[model samples]
Target: MITALLVLVAFGSSAQSGYDLWLNYRPMEASVRATQFKAMMSHVYFAGSSPQLQAAREELTRAAKGMLKTAIVNTPADQAQLIIGNIDQIAKRGDILKLSKAERPTGDGFIIRSVTNKGRKAVVVTGGTDLGVLYGVFAFLRHVQTNKDLTNLQITEHPKMMHRILDHWDNPNRSVERGYAGFSIWNWHKLPGYTDPRYTDYARANASVGINGSVLNNVNANVIMLTPAYLAKAKALADVFRPYGIKVYLSIKFSSPIELGKLSTADPLDPQVRKWWKDKVDEIYSVIPDFGGFLVKANSEGQPGPQSYGRTHADGANMLGEALAPHHGIVMWRAFVYDNNVPDDRAKQAYSEFKPLDGKFNDNVIVQVKNGAIDFQPREPFHPLFGAMAKTPLMLEVQLTQEYLGFSTHLVYEAPLFKECLDADTYAKGKGATVAKVLEGTYQPGKLTGMAGVANIGTDLNWCGHPFAQANWYSFGRLAWDPGASAEAIADDWLRMTFTNDKRFIDPIKDHMMRSRENTVNYMTPLGLHHIMSADGHYGPGPWTDKMPRADWTAVYYHKADSLGIGFDRTATGSNAVAQYFPEVRDHFADLSTCPDIYLLWFHHLSWNYKMRSGKTLWDELVDHYYKGAAAVQGMQKVWNGMRPYVDATRYNEVKQLMAVQYDEAIRWRNSCVLYFQTFSKKPIGDQYSKPEHDLQYYRSLHYYNVPGLGTN
Candidate 1:
């Protein structure tokens, strides 16, 4: 009895540690909503016994037990208060719920409704398939968690993108590139022999938000990951995730034919190379039948590709696409490439290289484009490729890890950043052609659409290093599932489910999350500034970093801060990079007066003394943004402190300490950039703002060593 009680205590403690993520399923507060949910979940009938159906049934039972404080009794369809199953199974009951052909759930879509038949009342959750049933179960739990009433429920939902995936940059050696939370969660050394329970929790959290795919390795691919030994380990994980409706994908090295197969050349046109990949793909399928396929990063960042043999990206992708065609798999060929030898705008290289190859790729090849033309900066215009590739499928890839937004130390909610790009009008097929529409394949129907987030998950106690950082992971999954979802609404649900239902706690915290990305942008890269972080780990400001192997890798190459002016000029007169966009977007960005102040410097070089939209000199306006950003961090500290009574001591204190560090770092960023840029402006920081704590030389001389997330490369 003592051991059992100890086990119970241990389980309770672990539940509050944030390892459960947003699916904590804490007990609901006593209220009308709680009573309603308890009654609705009292007697449940879940049809079918497949692994996917069983997983859904398990989740429903677990959630009901936790939130309603009662065991869910399995009952016949007529006696059950809640009926859960696929549409056909639910339809077996006569005249229970009638759905029109258009209203019926399709693909992975689901519908929830309140119905009455033969003097019996029940809430029926039905979907197109077993996977859809799993999603409906999660959505039903979310409604209860957010205190929503289910009496008059009429909800139908479907994922906006066909593939909502997480791209884990985790290495085989248990290190994660750009990961700030902790080491990689996959213990590859022991994987095939031992399956960890954490993997299930990870799948649960992902499924809760409708993420259906996971790529389990870094894009900087390794040949060993394709070996027979590792294949068995990956199969182990695939088996665990299959029940949760997640397909496992692996990132393959482009030269795997040569590196792993001992071939002389990995040319896509080489018959030997082509056969080698086909065999490897066959072996992979034999082990994991539901394998998602390969994600390739080639001809970029020194990774080998078909370019070595003078072949185009389509050649490389098609060769692999042909191998996986039988299994209906795809090749997510990354479009993050640039020639360091070429003296051109780095932002234009991807468009210049890929725009012409638009129609060349096979139907199974999807070119994964980053959200921005460049890497994931604090703020950037949507990638020009979004609407440009009408013939080829494109997937938007956003970073969930805080690589440039202060590396998990600062509270930066990324939903706004994602929405900013998704909502931007691409004007491809006219005014309504937003990036979201392009990603949803609205302009070009019957094409695969997807959104992949760089996974920020790790082995930390909180999963993410910062407690609030988990919100980024949550937000990415939510937005990927429905690009049209509001950031404010998502934050509201997250706050209530993760912390408390108290309005006082939810209201102010939601406001903080909504404004977080903008605040980080203000402090770190206000007014169109990009890529000025320190060279390696990207932890701190390094506006003076000009010594690098390549000019484009240097901060000065992008910012171009000189005595004359600041910012890179990408206009027609400059690199003509603006021409890459459709005329509507190009003309808007090209004209200085019309360009948004937020992106003023990204597309043009402006004088320090140029008049600003706010009627202040450019220099004065930049200074005010820096000060305002730092001050906002202090405001966040005060807001969080007031919530001590609402949150658990563990999570509340974790965020409290992290906020303090955030404020300190915000000051450092403000002072470092303000002082460094002042050298070019030759203007004094206005007396209204506090002077830099130290001189420019002091900030530049500061160096940090052994920073986390600098995995391998």
Candidate 2:
């Protein structure tokens, strides 16, 4: 299958393990279960009929029946083996069933463990709320699915970020922006009548990862979505997601006052425009009372905003936030704005526009900032805006789609990227001011916190295009729930759920994924080389690209590979973009010698002959990275090949075949980039690696003009 057409579909044949994702609820081999999970089914009891409660009941029932391949009989007896209940309903049973409260300060926490219920052995699943019950059920199912002993399973958990959302850049026309997955899941034309079962599965998968909200449209939004007709379409999805505790949000076009309401001006200060938005908010909430509010893309990349009327970003955000305040909704204003025709550095634009407007936003507004200052690159330093605003609610926005990372073809686990940013010490209010602390409300008081991922899900049978890509989605939710959680821990849980819990499968795969993103960065943009892909499609290498209208838009702007040196000088002598960060961070990137070598080239241009810490000249080190990256991918293929017995034949074969594509492409990336940059360095391939198969011109001629199943995010 082409890289772009991987869609999320629920059903696969009973003969294959690919369909189950990490939730493969297949009946365990009788011998294995008898020794491991048989204690899970001595008795069963469930209390409550709320939709969320029923959801938990149904999920557990389906999983248990599927894995055990037998009816788990309900027991009315006091010592039910699998006892389940909401906190209020379960407390009545008293000491006869002493269910210790799970230490979850948040509403969504669950504990499942063995306990003696009136002298009878029981496995109790109890939580403070229905959502907690749902989490408990999933947790319980995971234990059984992973063939773990159910005798003493005690777990309590809650989301770290108040709002973990998936922003689907899906349009009514079925086009998805930057989506490698198939067409949009929202079938607008048939939505009011025909409901796709996929919606339920999407919600279920998100709930499993503790993602509680989803914005159903693109940030480059269309005003038509707010109209009465489309609101009906959105309401259908909201209804399906409500039971799963996932509130639906919409991406609003700032010019909606003019387009949707037929007003003359969409100025933020105008009373008519303010009233128009307020009325629209009221209308939307009337239909979907729990509607999660608006995500706006004002004055960025052709999107209209308050800037159109000489108002700051705050003016636009506060105007909409005021409207949503009464209804308990929020306005997520994007901080991705950069002037289209300006010659200024792209990295400096967003900070310049947003830093001054920080404290002016309404309390209900969250400034949605991307992980990096520039657009999503193969690698980038954490965004300067993270700790710049001390008095405002802010949300971290991460891209799960792999738009700039080799798309679906490359096996890049993004948990490391997420962790790098979350763990970055911002030094805003003093030491220990991490980005996680800022958004999670640990450092800042009374501020609503959030994290969002640009979803890579679509209509594919497997959910994310690549089966392993599903893990990225899983990791994003886990990290959002608790940024302190280790990437390996999250990957371990996902491996057990998506595949076998066998050490052979888990250990090897985990090692491969943990190192995969770094390996990708090593080849594609080592030493901070970024945004060097083909002009339009952004698929392959195009480091020689130039002559665009804006100087910053060209690859030349980022990788200034001249005889003088290479890299954008963000130091005082250059763009001075480093000054945007806090002083602690500012000093780190301000000096070329002091700047971390990983970002050495990003902050300062260096002569090709400059000796690197690796004891090799800069030119040789760059070549080594390209070679090393390609070699690591080959190593991944070998690891996967050895695990043929651990995975289903279909998924195993799918991944195996894709590995061949990745290896071929990795070589292409290596050769093309190395050969192009070698022109400036005037260096040899060296005796360590083989010479390039083709020259730069030959590599450039291999035009991928026909992008199969491309998206426009």
Candidate 3:
């Protein structure tokens, strides 16, 4: 069947392994105890006729039939036990909600409450707008799917940021950049027709957690995406997404005017350049009126931008912002820029380039900054720009794809990494000013707020390559909705929905997830060691690797390992990148005594014999962290092995095998890092742990072929 319409799959059918995602309409087995939540959804009624509202109805029906073993009949708002609709629909039905000051929704916020109808309990899923109401429907379904109590139900929620987007780095041909999952899901050749049912499933999964936008192409753009042909294909996907309230956006090559329009110059200051963009944007809106906007990655990693014309980043961003503004669209201009020729620290390049242009950006443009000043490392201090850009609205961009964390092969729960950054005190507006508060416009009111994740999805049957990787995608959306949300809380909800609700299963898995990120860090780059992944592939450890076209691109440049000691010194005597932060944050990282052990190596170059806070020498601490990381994976394996009784055979086996691969890779990471770093420290591999199975030369000689994600292109 063509993909344009919804396609339902039978549970346990060979046709689908994970095409259902978390929206599995599979009913509870007879062996499992059922929830006492049937009364909450006894008689459902929806009061709106829009496509979005209709989708809300269909979703509820599908979920109710599966989870409660019955279908819902449409009834009048007041008579039905459950009423679902937007404010306009509720008002049309004579204010069935009678929204109170506390219960009233603001913007895209939703309120799910228990209201009295003739002295009978009735649940109302409603919001101030149709989009919000649709979100409420999904929220209600999630509550049921997780087997939570519905009585005295009151959930008032709104996204903390306006644009919670997933940036898919999928290219035109289907190959993904740094994508550990299989090929890209967007079948470009077959699009604009034969829509896949998977498209709808993707939308449903996104809306279930309140993600409202997506960038459908790679940041390393091709001008062809801006053409009429591809826009038609994009429009097709946008149509499928609209019912779920997700607006489609594109990543445009900054020189599109030159390549697509055959212009001599794509300069922002040039009149011809401005008119070309205006005309192109007009053409796009004509095809898809609600086309979200453009995501630009220019003057970074060799992509052309206004910098090619001797113009600042603001020049490039403001020009595009002007074109999108009339259509109520916005431009997301990336701040991941640096000049290789600039004789400055690579870590400090983005701040030096963008910090000066803060107030100069147009109001409609958001400066998209990576979570770290450097590329997506396993763990790095929060980007200095989090608080530095008061005049500019900054969007926190993180990677959901495990590019550095071991791709899809190894399991790493990313919410802890995200929370660490969000909770960090930027001190931009003095104490208690966190990165989350800054993104919420607490530091600068009336500014645009957004959070973006580099997508990990692909054409794999399970969606994310590893089954557990799905939790990272789930966590990103939940946190994007509310930055202050507990990572553990999100994991609990996801565990119950995606796996089992059994406490025996939930308790151990949640603990495993909470510790997963730190575990990967320990085995890989413990104690604040950042960006030591292998060159080009970034697939394996390569701290000893210094040979690359660009000096800073290699692992050796960041770690600065030498005969004296290891780690880079960002203090006043060194690169002094710490100065970019507010005085308090700078001072906090500058002092070795005051600095946290987790970030010691990131900020200072300490001696191998230097004492750590744990009372272990730097050499011993490093070795211990690497071994601890590998051992933790074994612990995870033990936990999952015990979950077999609670999980199905297919899922149980999938996770079991992945955990085995993770264990092997963890050992490899430990061995390679421990062996290589030992050369500089000249210390013995402590007698307690196993010695390196192979020498450093053995690892360096191990050449891999056809690793995924790094496209042949």
lDDT of 3 by residue, 417-474 (tens): 9999999999888899999999988877888899999999998777899988998999
Q: Against the true structure, what is each candidate's TM-score?
A: 0.98, 0.95, 0.97
lDDT of each: 0.89, 0.83, 0.87
- Top candidate, metric lDDT: 1
Model 1: per-residue lDDT, tens digit, 1-713? 01123424654564557766777688887888787777667767887887888998888777887777787778877777788889888777657778777888987889988888456677888899988988898988888888888778898999889899999999999999999999998999999999877788888889889999999999998889999999999999999999989999999999888878899999999999999999999999999998999999999988999998999999999999999999999889999998887689999999999999989999888999999998999999999999999899999999999999988888999999999999999999999999999999998788889999999999887789988889999999999999999999999888878888789999999998899899999999999999999996888998888999888888999999999989989997788899999999999999997999998889989999999989999999999999999999999999999999989888888899999999999999999999999989999989888888888888888887999998972
lDDT string for model 2 (227-315, tens) is: 89999999999999999999999998888888878899999999999999899999999999999999988888778888889999998
Order the candidates by lDDT, highest first. Answer: 1, 3, 2
Error of 2 at 666 (Å): 1.0
Give RMSD (Å) of candidate 1 vs. truth.
2.0
Error of 3 at 435 (Å): 0.3
Residue ranges of candidate 1 with Cα displaced over 4 Å: 1-12
Return the candidate ranking by TM-score, descending. 1, 3, 2
2 against 3, candidate with superior TM-score: 3
Give the residue spans of candidate 3 off by over 4 A.
1-11, 14-16, 28-36, 92-95, 101-103
